[model samples]
Target: MESPNNKRKRVKPILRCSTNEQSERSPDDQLAIIKAMADARDWEVLDPIRLEGRSGSLHATMDWAVEQVIAANRAGEDIDDAIVYDQSRMGRTGGFAFGTHKQQLAAAGIGFISVDCPIEGPHADFIQFANAEAARAQAISIAASSARSSQISLERGLRGHSTQAPYGLDRLYLNAQGEELFIIRKLADGTSLRLDPRTGAELERYPKGVRAYRKGGLETATLCIGSEEHRQVVIRIYRLRHEHGWRGVRIARELNDAGIPSPRGRHWTKDTVDGILMNEVYLGFAYARRYTDAIYFRHQDKAPERLEGPGGRKVRGYRPREDWFRVEYPKLTEYLPSKLRDAAARWQAAYWDRYEDGHVRSPERGQKRLHALSGILIEETTGQPMSATQSGTRANPKTYYLLPGSHQYSSQESFLRRRIPSAPLYRAIIDEIEMLVCDDDGLRDILRTEILKAEAERRAGDGEAESLRARYEKLGRKMESQIDLLGEDDDDVMRRKVEQTKAQRRAVMERLAEIDQGPRLTADQTDELVEQLIEALQSELAAFAAAGRPAFRKLTEMLIASAVADLRSGTVSIEFAVPASMIQHRFMGMDRPCEPKWRTHTHKWKSLPLAAITVELPERCDMDCWEPFEPKGCDDCRRQRRTA
Candidate 1:
């Protein structure tokens, strides 16, 4: 090897041409320019890389080249710098991505030679001015590119180009004189042409090819026509989903069972069926340019600086409806005689309803809780809800909510077994609720009083509300005036004033929203709802039973709060969500402390009834006049005799 100091520096050129302008300035032209630049310095140049518009921060194109530079420098080779045609082409994502790439290259001790941006570093602050111009140009170029793409797609759609016709329709490629053109799937000569994916028309080139297809004398390109078999299938699918009420999966299964091959020649799947259902083409609407490059790189967290995906390919993402070019083809009705549009709409509505409502997962047949008291039962020892466990086999099942002690360690001596059956537990709970509701001195009365008081407060509009509203409106106008007065003079002072006024306005609006509930509730409707709620609670057991598990859970949580069982003490403690007025009465005239610790502020929980734990007993087991007691013997001798 030559002496270490006598090595020639190796420089590699990075050449790129975006697909948008590939024809105007091909990669070959860019490579020639780079080669000329290297020739002037007599530096040994490596083969130039053609990125062809790969995505990332402007610096991303330099990444692979920099890696090579690092390796060459480390291996005692003399690679120190990478050459590029222009610096601004490195990125258009603005400072962040470009800055990151610069930092990375600096860490690798690699330098770059920009043909256009020759001046850089701390002494070259003026370079940023030139860069700003380039950035603006890039932005304009991006916008123009987007407009061109939209125009091209619009042209193709209306001209009857049959690249990829939507479902329920097929592309029939015809010349200008209505003579059909054949699609050659394979090439016969030393030429390049391929079928268009959307319209199925043979076109020249691979990817960026111009169509040699020409029409003469009153002939257009291709026309989409209804495919008889597919058209019938589409209509039937809509009917099955909407009219007959079927799930997407069910429809797909039926199609597969009928030996109907999908367009892709695969077994039908639910997503395939969903796509057909959602396609608007069957409804006579054709949408173009619904997907775009921005959408391809679009991610929820943040917009990417470069257009690329993790898989090194463009990712197709959803675009908004407004961006799509929509055209109507009313001729779709000819194939679908009975338009089941309403049915399709209903099907979509039903799907959303089920998705939002959520389905309950059914337990094993033996484990399913036929009685409502199954889930809420609490174990006092562990402070965890009791779980339903089956003791016997599937043939003969016995389900019980068992509390196996602290940590649920299944201690034989310490665990609590079921004291009551599931059915009886529900009966007892319902009876307690009924008593708490039907009695005049019960929770129902307290709730009713609170409701009436709230309504009365709402009806009597605040006397201070109108003044607050006026202040709010005035503050808003003052803020607007302050903003308008903002000038180069004393900007800080104006900003401070604006902020202070906004705070005041926000405070006013908050109080206003609190006072203004919009058109007060009708007295009759209020009374009716109050009555209905009370009636619902005292409703017959059948009515109570009619309540779904979810409704039951809500009501229980609203009123009962929580329930706990203590096996050792043989007692179950209950807490009520209902408030206790007896405690609140003590807090009157004591909103503030006379002397710090002496005054107490009441929290919502403290105002509620003190949590009570008592021995839980079946409602029917309460002393009947006919049953004899050990202490009192019997209420009457005849009653005792009847029991005996």
Candidate 2:
């Protein structure tokens, strides 16, 4: 047997842990592990080496630890292995120390052991691989839960776990005697609470009930923006959407480029920026959901496309806006009040109307199908542009006609010229165009100069490019500042900063290309542009034909024919299927059509009577077949009824 001293020198067995612990945690917890090692008289505890002279300096501690491990190897001690408390305290950085220092130590026959981990042995060459993986998983879990809880709390208007209070607010804390602290009346709406302003005490509790500013006081704070930190957030949100005129995507990109910290001090996303833009709380009100679970709630992800049923049709309903709870918090504008919002709302409303009007999502229900010429047709009476009206149907389908009341005899004249069958007239117009214009020279001219000019002007006036350029400049400055602050030795930091700057500059340059102040086209450019428009219309016709949707094809053909007819000549006229004046349920048992007695007829007594044709024009009559009809009476008679 060996002597007593030799027996005392024997190394204790390294602890092995199972995969599961308390509540899915491993059985070998941190405290349990430390006690077990102490009880077994382990060879060494291997406490993280602290720099002798320097404290709280990570670099110094790491250098000292590296030196200590190297020295122990040279000392000729029977150092079979080293043990550490856990992955985090073992090395300052994630895997740098373990993969570098630990690997070198193990090469000299020493092994590294983590008491609370199951990973071990010679095969575990990269001990950091295991430690880093565990650390990463822990971080992700913490982040996900924290994000979920924050979302729930915000939605419910509840106070979250935070340290600071807004400006004008004071946090009350316990005194040395553990008694309720004194109240400080600095609380402001829309502000976060931090340390007590008057007493300089740290806030360690929730329900630190806030107090409003004294009415009509000079120092009365408006917002709950407790600190300068939160004030910056409010300013940034306004700068992005209002000052810069940035859309949601641009706002996110700008924030990311500037390296501005989000509410949680992380990178910003489109959703985060959108949330800020939509949030009214910053406008001086706190509107949050009333109740929510205290824990994380994960909504199920939407199913993949292949797994969706029946083309993923959505149900429709009206959700009253008033029913949604809203509490005004301190804020600026409720939302960016601009033409962009109005335009977006109009588009959404129009889209919904198209779908709901005919109980189908098709061009037949869309205004673009029939009203492509809506803005061009002027009422002789009102001198205003005509507006299209949709008359829904069950037996025949949906029909579109111009609104009435602009011309004379609108209240009494039965203005039903054509209905869904008017599509045939549209088709006939296209056929006539094919016969008249051979090379599309005239059509191209109109498209290139006339219509495209208007569209280009509208696009140029839009502030999108200007906003992006401003955002790019802002981001560039921020990135340059960050780069300058980085140490010369930090190659990774410099490279990343340089790359980000290059990308942002490139985006800004692209936006500059779209900024056009000059005339969109020269006289020579009109023909080509008009030709392109015709070609696009032809493509639409082909698409409808291929899909076997006749109504859509007719609609496209009609719009092109009407536009061409209007521009080629000076006048544009459209005959509708059913006039608004004629819209009424039939009287019971009525047989013959009868004009109401109040309706009056007006016509010039031309010596020659107009000839009525025997063969009715194929609701698809070619444009060549119809001649321009001039009204000899009042201008009101010349204009088609608003209900025609």
Candidate 3:
């Protein structure tokens, strides 16, 4: 036997949600529960329901939903009431605010009805006050939970634990041999274990020979200098932001235009560039809690209601820097000096152009060397690195490459002696690079052969994972279908069915998650990618023979680790990062000294490529002195004295 009713009360369903409340059941589901109750009570649910956004108080969306009931009645749609799944969805802002909205709805004769929120009948006023308190309690709980998680993550950063290595830094070498590194697995007794790559047996002690486990490179990670091919892009990004005073968006655009790959293998964006700029990890100081509140885009028209103010596109609440936990790595510190890094940060923050900009055109004109040799040139006199700067106004700029020095170097080289016309020197070095690439095929051969092969081997393992992903997608569709077939009833049989479907879905999801940890590229895919690269390089080689900057900056960074003008020797030392052990000293044998003619009348100087300079040969390649020269890096302690 079933009870029947003739009159169906026309009602509108309303739901409000905060952007952070992802764990809450969806609005549609909540509406379905409301609809089920409505149907039982012989109520007619209207079209065009309202679902709004909130963290706590969102006045506009709720205001629009309330007005809609009045408008519908005026238009002869005769909306009798506005129903909410829960009364708390009405407002947790304040009891007064909640009561005011309730009064307005009552005055409109569109009685406010809450379906599952059980305080709608007798003692409704008491229940309403209690509901408001509960809503406040819920918001406090969510905020408290969020703060706790953030504190934990921030604390981990302070303890020198990182989810990822900083931009322009990776590969924690095992020892001075620089045989890469790995996750140091420790037993319960605190014994560090490294499984032998060949034997799979646990070593009693940390092995000196082991490297990180990779599909192809079980022996080593990619060796990098500050100008390492892929890594140099990051170096370029840092320079663009700090040294040149370019905004993150501009930097990202430049990188995108140059076809440089982002960390996640996509086009760069301002947000990503901003992350790198703010990332303390680059300075070898770990910091967290910069991003606590996540961002979401609120679509226009699709937005629940008109926003109250000038915002809705992006929402983020930042924690103060003092509240952040930071850890400093004394040994791992590299790249920019602390003084320069700090100054750059302050300058960027102080900049008005960074805030309200289409763009402030680069101070210098022409295709500037925002890559490779931007920070590579060193002055022999004061042991200083050349920096990029512009002398003339933005409209007609005269870019100068200045060799600014440390306190000691500053005392040595007078201010007037540091500035040099950048264009001629930059053009000359680029010409020299073109000459080297035109004549020698050492780097090209490596990229086309060994590098491509390594890439292929690494990617070969992704086929199974791809197949698993396909299976997972199909499995998801089947689960959705099974769910759709189930009735909306909450009886024990339906509940059991729901539980079974959930368990099945979870098992499949667990397997999918497991596969996510595996590789996503195949060797076949890599081979195709490599073939495309080879074609591009071959086509571009002939064009590079003409006098111009090379298309690929990574290749330039690879061939020339650094360029130094040795004024005393009348030679510019261009150190090449050739992989050959015997070739290091042999390149000096082909030395030919020549004076470089300068466009400026201020100084008379001679320069020659380092490849063309003569030096006393080392007996063999010493891994100890293999790293690129740093101001106070390992090269200083090398017992081998340079005989020029």
Clashes of each: 12, 52, 7
**lDDT score, candidate 1:** 0.50
The segments of candidate 2 whose C-alpha lies over 4 angstroms from its true place after superposition are: 1-194, 198-223, 256-259, 264-266, 290-644
Per-residue CA lDDT of candidate 3, range 1-644, in tens? Answer: 01112124677777666542231455767778888997677566787455534544544455556666654544345456777878777755445556767787765446777776645557887778777667756754554554454344344332233433444554332433544444333222223354443343554443322322322212322211222454567667777866788987678767766777666556566777887776655555554443333222211221211113222112333434543445665544555666656765575456423323222122122423554455566767656667667655676555555554221122222342444444444444444444433332443454445444433442325476577557657767766766676676655665676667555655544344333232332455434433443344333444443423444344444345466755444345666433221121222222223422211111111111224322222223234322222111112223112210
lDDT of 2 by residue, 1-644 (tens): 01121212212122222111121222234435655764575333333333222211132344445546544533333344555556544543335534665666555445655655637556665666766545544544553565555444434434322223332223333344434333332332232334554555655322322222212211222233334555566456656666567766566556656666555455555666666555444444433322221111221112111112121122122223332334444233333244534433444445334423222122122222444344344433335445455543565343333424222222232231122223333344434333222234433443344344444533445677678768878888887887786777887878788878766765565445434433333444444434444554445444543554344434432343122112112234443211111111111112223433211111001111111111123333334433322211111322223212
Off by over 4 Å in 3: 1-8, 19-25, 46-53, 57-78, 107-109, 118-122, 141-240, 243-245, 248-276, 279-324, 327-644
lDDT of 1 by residue, 1-644 (tens): 11122223456666655543253356667667767776676456776656664543333344554545544443333344666777654544455444555566555445666666656667543464456446645654665564454355445443432344555564444555545564323122212344554576556553332233433334333334444677678888888876788877678768877877666555566777888886666655655545443412321212222343321123343445444456565555344444477555555456444433323222122222323344456877656667655555677444455653222122342345444334334444544554455453354456556655654543325567788878989999999999998986899999999989987876665455344233433555445544554454445322444553334544454356566777656556666534222222323323343334312211111223322435454433322421321211123354334333
The global Cα lDDT (0 to 1) of model 2 is: 0.39
lDDT of 1 at 267: 57
Between candidates 1 and 3, name the one with more favorable TM-score: 3
Cα error, residue 75 of model 2, in Å, equals 33
- What TM-score goes with each of the models? 0.33, 0.22, 0.33
Q: Candidate 3 has what TM-score?
A: 0.33
* 333: Cα error in model 1, Å: 8.2
Best of the candidates, TM-score? 3
